[model samples]
Target: MSADILTFRPAPLSQADAARRRAMLLHPSNFVPASAPDRDATEKAEEQAGRFDALYKEFLDRGLSANGARTEVARAAAREIWDGFAVQLRQHRAAGQQMDANVLAVALASIQCLNSVLPRRPEDPHHAVRAVSTARRRLQYNGGLLHRLHPHRNPAFQDAVATLQSLEVFLTRPQQHAA
Candidate 1:
């Protein structure tokens, strides 16, 4: 008696089909990743964003239309490109770090909108500035707990403070260009 073995195999897609799949995976409009204040992470995310833009532009040049597949693909690309930032944001939120959480949340949300479609703009610094401003107001009302506390005393606190500071600097930079 011989035993029969079963193997699973999936169907292969054509080049066009595969391209579509990749586009779908990369498109993102609402969900955006947060890149915190680390230079490396921020730079890496920025690089990926540029790549995403190039890919989307090529897709549009292909057959993708703004009102059709292109829009979806762009959204996917945006979400996937910045996916790393989400993890950092979630961690900060889990740690109950208000300033970090708010800053990242604002940045991510703003960038998503800015890059969602044609005439897509770079992540607006205004969103980040607004976030920090709101957080500062909260801190003032709450007796400036973060300012009073020493970051060096706690590693996590130190990281959170550093991130907030860096994010503020990043946000404030665009205004210089405008002038």
Candidate 2:
């Protein structure tokens, strides 16, 4: 037997191959098939809206003003979304698998939502602004990396970016006091 050890080196993927791989990784169909019926989608959306309306009505019944009820509902929803993301992140880490782009997008969006609902500290009004600014910078950097890797327009990613932008706007606005 020869003393030399042979190593196998795979050839670089062609552009078409790269594109196909990216599509496989980033395609929405991987989670929910693109061919899913429109009726199912509509039903799911309507169900979610109904749940929100029920919760809002419940809060109103509890004697909260409409604005207060809306704020409370937003906070609760944001908390739930953030908690779900945390669980998914933990699961992915436990499995030693790289996070899917969609997961990252959802997590970022959840963070934005949570930030928007968080009550600013009277003593440190600028704290939220600074924190959100830092987060936005980091998110933009990572988002750019994800875009480069996937080389596709992901609607989830776009929505997450938009959510972050909205959070920035929310942070800049003066706090509204309930009269």
Candidate 3:
């Protein structure tokens, strides 16, 4: 025998309820009004606007949406940060701070790429995989570059790459446990 499931029915909304809904939707608290200073700041904002011009060109070249270009901009910013970290690794070596420099570079690159993604679409499995791939590539290329710069083909370079491999395994675990 199948049991019948009864669900509760909500009463029809009255005119007052409709009005309240409209009021809530249009509430001032839901929107911040721009002040005169805000307007002035935008009008006279120092030239960051010019930066987006090439971004538009990049989008046109790639036949991508503005949003896609914006995402690429975030990824590029991470790469730039990793480049700066590469310089720091050299400084650390000169100072006799002797942990594997490439390892440090891998960690920094992984962190940068992970942090770089904006408006993350974690619900999309493909996007999550893509993020992991980007991180892995950054770590791999940085390690390769560091190895090329080494004077004597030391084992430390191999160890550094191994460290990055461990990180990649840690990073690419099945997404179900990721959350």
Best by lDDT: 2
Q: How do the predictions measure up, each by TM-score? A: 0.28, 0.43, 0.31
Tens-digit lDDT string for candidate 1 (1-179): 22322334446689999988766754443223334347775564344333334454565577655333333343454354236346767988999987776555544553443243323422433543454444433322222233233222223333333343334443344332311
**Candidate 1 Cα RMSD (Å):** 21.8
Q: CA lDDT of 31 in candidate 3? A: 42
- Candidate 3 structure quality by residue, lDDT tens digits, 1-179: 22332335555689999889866855535443323335444333223334434644575488755445544444444454456567768876888766555556555755465564533752343453466456655554545454444532334333333433333332343423321
How far does residue 14 in candidate 3 sit from its true spot (Å)?
Answer: 87
- Stretches > 4 Å off in candidate 2: 1-48, 101-106, 109-113, 121-145, 151-179
**C-alpha displacement of 162 in model 3, angstroms?**
6.8
Q: Spell out the clash pairs found in candidate 2.
A: none
Candidate 2 residues 137-171, lDDT tens each? Answer: 55555555555565554344444434444444443
Error of 2 at 83 (Å): 0.8
Q: How do these models rank on TM-score, best leading?
A: 2, 3, 1
